[model samples]
Target: MEELFKEYEDKIPAILLEELKSSIDKKTTKTQLKKMLEALYEEYLESMVEPGESVGIISAESIGEPSTQMTLNTFHFAGVAEMNVTMGLPRIIEILDARKNIKTPMMEVYLKEPYNKGKDIRKVAELIKETKMSDIIQEVSINILEATITVKLDRQKMKDLEVRDSSVKRAVEKQLKSGQVKIEGDEVLIKVKSKDDSLNDLYKLKEKMKSIYLKGVKGITQVLPVKRKDEFVIITAGSNLKDTFKLEFVDTERTTSNDIMEVYENLGIEAARAAIINEVYRVIESQGLNVDIRHIMLIADTMTASGSVKGITRYGVVSDKSSVLARASFETPIKHLINASLVGETDPLNSVIENVMLNQPIPVGTGLPGLITKVKK
Candidate 1:
């Protein structure tokens, strides 16, 4: 039994090391790494693998965190001046495992010295807030207007412009009684009840004034236009519109160049951009396509960088160096075998035998096959 355990332990590390190497070569994003690990864990369970059978074999949850915080300190180690890392989720796991301090799947680690505490957490929170806000504003429109006041009319509270002989109250009453002015809410409206040709001229002037104000507002809201081969493209310039594009699905069909331009005219450039990105993301998600959040993030970044939305790629935000073989190797029963070998002090071959005796999961691409041994006389 001891010899068998030793054999299993030796093989466990070898398998795990190979998996780590593959992960590095592929430059797998953090999300991909997590998915690969989860698939392997499922295989381990089916094979009924046990702990202490492998080296460097950890639970799936050990390396999985929805968010990660890293803290670094600049210092000199061995005459090398550089940044020394003190705290991070990954580092914490490594330290705890090295010391065999915990066996739980999820845990947290805190640092004491050489670390600027709470800084990274604050930064991450701020960034998330900014991202969420940008996402929300991507669909809205902004407009600014300036207008000139015309036909000003005023009635004095005093009955006489010469106030030497009149009381203020009496003068105010006289103004209200007269048809010289009208008050609507806080505004004073002067009635221009005249059929003179000059009144028509005044009306025309008011219309012109309003038109000019609208044009000025439109100019401020104008955004950079995209040059398409056969059509003109336009997008808003605002973080909110960019973020709205992050949604899984919203509305894409209505997000054409003309529609975007219309938004620019009605809402302004910032609101138009937000609307377009939101619509684009909505369309992509509605098609049942699987895309990483990082891909969307990259698109937003590219749009901002070039001041136009175009040229997004899979490899832009995330890599595609996936390996089926490497993924399968990590899923094997090798970890359990290695742990058992190390604990029982045996060899790889013996470890396999003992694992089989325990009816534990064995390493296979999808799952370990059931085997039957026959005795001959």
Candidate 2:
């Protein structure tokens, strides 16, 4: 391997020198010429793959003294056909190094280009074979286990406690009557019963019990509750906000816009958005769909901008013309309107552009778009 590498390395510099001479226009100063050639060579070197520190491959041993040589005669057309000249080992080394990085290790390289173009691919394969590196690289897949806990109280305890105290029993009965407790097999499932599902109480409970329960399970990764019509969701084990959102639903008639905003206010906008995005990405990825996280970032930003939890395709906060896309496309109506009103036409577009470029939305509507549109004559 060292001998092979050395052969290629020796051939690279001469190729580079020749290519540089032919490519540059009328450069007479030796110092200037050498500098330019050196820079190009350095660039070519930099483009080669750097073995990651964790890869455990000693660089000095792997990249032995390069020695390789090849000559080519080609024609160039700049008006009339002219003699095209080329030369050196350095350029070849550069190409070989680049090809090594470009080709997936231990994989057959299939090249598609003009004229016997698969030559590079074949060359890369030959290099891999010659270097005896076919078995050195391995592919790894990682699996992460994310677990959450859902707590269920003993129904007997709940009922007994209610029966023991008349006033507390009355309150508990009221909650049960209101469908707060779902009884399943002697277990009292206690979920949040308020329209405003604030997790402060749950947080308090978790804080109080966390140390005691820490030994039983892993620390609470995320605390999320499900929300239902006119009822708050129970905070269970998972921290996935998006899943929590799906578990939460509001009856359009029973829940008011104020109620939704209040819920968002209780959970910080960033946290809420992160949860929603995590859930969205989870669903998307599970289906073997590929989407950049930045798209989710945009969705999160839009959701948080209005302080209302809405889906990506929803036409409320995200669909507004004064949001991120509008600013990016130079069509922010709200900013333009504000600037036009305050600074008039004399204001520079640059200033308005700069001002609206901040990743925030201008307040309009309920911040949350209404589902039902009211018609007017």
Candidate 3:
């Protein structure tokens, strides 16, 4: 086989050759092998992009057309009304814009070994689900006359949340360091340390008790254990990728966050790029749109090419464009033009936008060819 394709060895890619070699079995014939190679070669040629093609425009149009038909709403999770996933046009927009803080930031956390096999999933969910002081408290009553605040703890709720009286007392004392917190049966008494503490101060302390961190992972507002295929997974309302990965039972490789910047910062630019493409594709596919993955890949590559996740907007990827005309063409023409002029920038008319701005044929496809004159010899 090597001798048969010796002439075309340099032409064929090494990866394709390796794939062909790995796919062949002992019973495979020389004729069958030759035919398969030919078919693969044809496929490789057919998939190649044409020189000077306006791929950017094509990609934009491919995705943009289907996006208009997408629903501008989130899908509610069955049995969990609070867990609504941001899908459709809004989700696509959020991903493309690379918003630092997403509206409904979430995480799909995969577990390892026995945990993934559905062992103690509810307990794991309870452990990670952020428990605030307000969640366990039945009510708060302030006694202005006594200059003290009384917080009634829900013992049943605390038991369900897997929290103890000692833990609650410790958390309250540590959180309200300015005040003295004493656990009296199921009630927590908060008294101001200052002898001259006013009624307003007592009221303020009572209000502060509502948001104190009691237990569980920070930023993980809610966690729901879900069964997928043969494994159990945790879907969270809020995301904290960095800390979530540190959990012993978590499958770090499979865990992902919806926030692009969070992924970029914690996972790296490459992961962010993949996340952008997958996220956009997921949104599009969820809406039953058939936009090609290549289009999403182009958008993802553009967003993460600068070693950082950037939005497709004027302030993000557009602002980083080397071509002044390209930047000006996106949005805010005056701002781009003034900034370019102030910096003594020159438009070489090498790109599509700059050439088009001057009422010239854009340097793409047939327009890319320069006129050549022949001299008689």
Candidate 4:
């Protein structure tokens, strides 16, 4: 196997070779291995584009055609409404647009070792879901006469969550920087820290204190523990990739967020690229569309090739195009033209759009090759 691999290492792709080696057994003969290598190499060659092929347009059309048949509804419950995911055309558009704030930001948190086997499923789920001060509080009252806010904490809920009152006090004190928090029996008393504070400020503080981050992962509104195949997984409604990774039980390698920007920030551009491809493919697959994966990969490559995830819009990938005409053709022709003119830019007519604008042969396919002849001297 080693010798066979060495014989075709330069000819075949490393990824293809690796897959072939892993699938084949010791009983496989050398001749069979050589034949397999040749077949893969041939297929690879056939899969490659022709010189100066207009691949970008083809990929666009391929993706665009199937996208029209996609479902209009954005959310797909997949039998669990709590885990409702954005799907179909809206999701594809959301990803391709590279919108910073997606419709539904979610994360799939995989656990490590014992926890993954459903040892502490509910406990793990509770630990991930964001617990606001209001959620764990039984009642909140504002005293007009004394100008104090009284919060009665639900001891049962706190006990079930294994959250101590001291921890709650600390969390409240941390958030309510200008207020004095005191524990009176089972109720938490909040008094103005400054004598100059007004009733409006007190009301504002009361509203703000309700949202204080008391426990669990912040931004995670809901968490559902699911037994996927055998391993238990936690699906969240909100994405906080950075904080989620800090948890000791989380499997950072397998745990991933659906927000592409979040992935890019927490992980890197490569991971973001993979996320984009996976996310787009997932939407298409869910919609029962048959668009080619290569088209999706091509778009992903374009989006991440610049070392950042750029949208397909004018402000993103289009703005960075080398050809002024290509940029103009995408969107805001007047603006692009004005900017190019202001900069005294020149179009070399190397790409498709520029040549088409000049009414010349678009430099792709047969037009890519130019004639060079020597005349009689």
Q: Which residue window of length 10 is worst by lDDT in model 4?
A: 74-83
Write one digit per residue (lDDT tens) for candidate 1, span 1-377.
22332433443445753564455544556566555555555665566645443322222222222212222222234533222232233333322222222111110111222221333433222221211111111122111121112222223311112221122223322432322333333233333334342544544433432222111111112232333343332333222333323322313223332233344444554654564455344433443443444443433444334343222232221111132222223334465446445677333422333345557654432334456889898
TM-score of each: 0.18, 0.23, 0.88, 0.90
Q: For each predicted model, how many residue pairs clash, with residues at least 3 apart or on different chains?
A: 44, 25, 0, 0
64: Cα error in model 1, Å: 34
- Model 1 TM-score (2 dp): 0.18
Better of 2 and 4 by lDDT: 4
Across 184-281, the per-residue lDDT of candidate 3 in tens digits comes to: 99898887777588777777788788988987788898888888898888999899988888889889989998889999999899999999988888
lDDT of 4 by residue, 1-377 (tens): 68879988898789988999899998999889888888999999998887889889899899989888877887655675366778888888889989999988999999999899998799989999888888878999987667789999888998888888898889888888866889987899988766566778878988999999877898999888888998999999999999999999999999999999999988999999999999999989877888889899999999998998999899888888898999999888999899999999998778888888889998788888999999999
lDDT of each: 0.33, 0.35, 0.86, 0.89
Candidate 2 regions with alpha-carbon error over 4 angstroms: 1-163, 168-263, 307-315, 322-377
Please tell me which predicted candidate would have the highest TM-score against the true structure: 4
Candidate 2, position 226, lDDT: 28
Q: Can you tell me which runs of candidate 1 are displaced by over 4 Å?
A: 1-181, 184-199, 205-279, 287-295, 306-377
lDDT by residue for model 2 (110-217), tens: 122221233233222222121111111122111112111123333354342222223332433453343243334422333444534344554443333222210111
